[model samples]
Target: MTSLMALVVGVLYAAAIYMMLRRSIVKLVIGLVLLSNAANLLIFTAAGLRRDAPPLVPDDAQVPAGLVADPLAQALILTAIVIGFGVLAFAVVLIRRAYEVVEADDMHQMRDTDT
Candidate 1:
């Protein structure tokens, strides 16, 4: 499972980079989304995939009695997801406005309008 996740992360990273390098603004946004997902997955994978009990302590005990899934990674991923969504939304809006004003989705074409 870890190996599979690692492979997936690697593929996502590669695809994201490829898309980000394209001249199209839409592809760049897609790449940014992919990159954010890849980062989240990387954090999740690094935290391990053990399907143990939840990280909760018994009412009578001060700590959990057995191994438990790490909550830090989950929390971090959740936070990242929210942040990624916001960032993606902003990027899309910005791109849409730029496209409307510049009449071009390609960066090179848009740059030519600076005159």
Candidate 2:
């Protein structure tokens, strides 16, 4: 499962880079979204895959029994997801405004108007 996830993450990163290199502004946003997702997946994969009990302790126990999933990676991924969503929202709004002002979705066309 870890190997499969690693492969998936690699593919997502590759796709994100490809989309980001496109000339369309919309594709760039899509690529950004993809990139963020890939990062989250990478973090998850690095945390290890297991069907362990949740990281909880019994009232009498000082620590969780047996293997427990790490919470730090989950927290990090959650934070990243929220931040990524915010960034994506801002990027969408910025792209919309840019499109309205430049009247073009192509980066080349937008660049030509910089004069």
Kindly list the per-residue Cα lDDT of model 2 for residues 1-115, writing each as its tens digit. Answer: 9999999999999999999999999999999999999999999999898888889999999999988999999999999999999999999999999999889998988766478
Summarize candidate 1's per-residue lDDT along 28-68 as a digit string, tens digits. 99999999999999999998999799999999999999899
Report the number of the highest-TM-score candidate.
2
Q: How accurate is candidate 2 locally (lDDT)?
A: 0.95
Residue pairs clashing, model 2: none
Off by over 4 Å in 2: 112-115
How large is the C-alpha RMSD of every model relative to the true structure?
1.8, 1.6
